[model samples]
Target: MNLKKLLVLVLVMHSDAGIAQNLDTPSIKETSGYTLANLSIDSQITMFYYTDITPAVHFYGDILGLEKTLDWSWVVFFQTGSSSFIGLVTEGHDAFHDVQPSNAVMLSLVTNDLDLWYERLRQWNEVTFLKSISDSGPIRSFMVEDPGGYTVEFFQWLTPTE
Candidate 1:
């Protein structure tokens, strides 16, 4: 190697952190170095199975103003973000996941216009507030109950995100 190249290599080798760990080891698990064979996710959709899908559809499409990607009798999809979607599904015997009395899922929407949303939601009689507008550490948020009894949260980051 040239003299300049050799000197630079020696300096990096003797850094304060000492020798770095070898990264050539084959990865086979779920942690760092894990590998997937050209797997790319296009988008994600979180679905809520409801006993009655009409009001749920109106809540997302009309109240929330999420543009519908697809609409049908059984299901409706709304684009919440560039790569995220929320779907409302009709509950029936033929449905993939049968509707239960209670659901554990909470749809959290991150937005910058938190106050504007809160004001808009307040004016609508259709929206029922589960939690009033409040602050929670790194975020300010509020929760609302949808027509299907799903908890939807709107939050805004208070501090800079990494």
Candidate 2:
């Protein structure tokens, strides 16, 4: 009846009870009687509506260096990452008809080379610089506006201090 033996016995008993409970309980698909076969969520796509998609395509694909994945005339999808995409939809064509650029939402792009990005973006005359590259806080970042007026923040995370 040592303390360590008692603790081990208690843990084993608890684990057994948990396993028994899990075996008895029905899964969501069984209890709800609804299979998730209809819904297969994988990637994420942020859609921005614009009156004309040319400028958006130029800014996202050409300037930002995002690869153009799909083009549907009304909507053009740019691959941001392996599973993330930014879609520019022609206004009045898709689900959004009366939508306008609010410039409220800020899309952040994390990078390892902040200085290189800053230098490149600074040279682009079409980019509206919102903030200069500053490493004052936890994140070293610079904000700029896209052709569709979306605030794009390029940032690099600073190493945590001991």
Candidate 3:
């Protein structure tokens, strides 16, 4: 296998370590400071989705909604009904590959109305590659992206009416 092909294969198999590290960071808050002694070391899965947004991800702010919240270049924060929370941060925030923005990580979001979200996202010229919705086991999902080039997925998990 050629070097480029091998590299692509590796990337496909594993998520970027840089993104995992950024997600594990004690606190992503730039303005606020938190130390180890002051921080609660909780062992949990928190997804910090990132992208290579120019001008640093920190320059952005949060766009809060009823169920989801998107941070400027920083991250899109979401909490599942199970009480699990994830932060989607854009690239160029911490030290990673080159100081400039290039590529970050994949981010996902859940919505009750997948079609409505798709329609709204379509109206925005920035969004690209509107994938078709897929039904898998218990959920129907689709994907899209923001203007900054980060993949955003919308999913709706179905519950058996029984």
Candidate 4:
């Protein structure tokens, strides 16, 4: 089976939320034996891009210990959980640049301790902290630009009692 078909089968089987009526379903063309599916992702998936050469794969693999689902061309997919994935794509690559690429998208991360990441990132020479811990009402978070200009955020939500 082709990669497209394989992806469809995997998604269909592992879909956390049942397919709703409004969802554009994947249809197979009879003659071609190929299916055309909308790349409409569920809410859990996130895609991030990098412009210059960076060790994103290493960071996700070695540091974060995420297994690669697919690594091809300028795109790399890392499986975060059973149903979630993290996408890393080369910014200048045709696949990504064909559409407008924006650095304005801030990746928000909910972690156990924001200070742990904030302290750890300080040891990395390549990473730059954009802001110290900032309060957003009930949450305390910090933003750091990674080696490839992608903002890696770490945050913790404050409880009402705390």
Best by TM-score: 1
Report the Cα lDDT for candidate 2.
Answer: 0.76
Q: TM-scores for all candidates?
A: 0.76, 0.72, 0.42, 0.58
How far out, in Å, is residue 120 in model 2? 1.4
Question: Which residue pairs clash within candidate 1?
Answer: none
lDDT of 1 by residue, 1-162 (tens): 543563355456545654433333365433554444334568989999998899988899889889999988898899999999998999884679988788777887889999999998998997999999988656688989999888998988677468
Report lDDT (Cα) of residue 116, candidate 2: 92
Candidate 1 ranges beyond 4 A from true positions = 1-38, 160-162
Local distance difference test values of all predictions, in order:
0.81, 0.76, 0.50, 0.65
lDDT of 4 by residue, 1-162 (tens): 543563365456545665553343354345455433534556466787665324887776665556888888588888866777778878665654432354655555667767877777777666677888877655677877755566766777667564
As a TM-score, model 4 comes out at 0.58
What candidate 3 gets wrong by more than 4 Å, as runs, is 1-104
Give candidate 1's whole-model lDDT. Answer: 0.81
lDDT of 1 at 13: 54
Q: Tell me the spans in candidate 2 whose CA falls farther than 4 Å from its real position.
A: 1-41
Runs off by more than 4 Å, candidate 4: 1-43, 62-66, 80-82, 91-102
Q: Is candidate 2 or candidate 4 better by lDDT?
A: 2
* Candidate number of the best lDDT: 1
1-162: candidate 3 lDDT, tens digit per residue: 443563354445344453344444546445467533356635333454334543223212222122454444454555543555555555466524332254354444556887786676556454465577777545577766444544556777567467
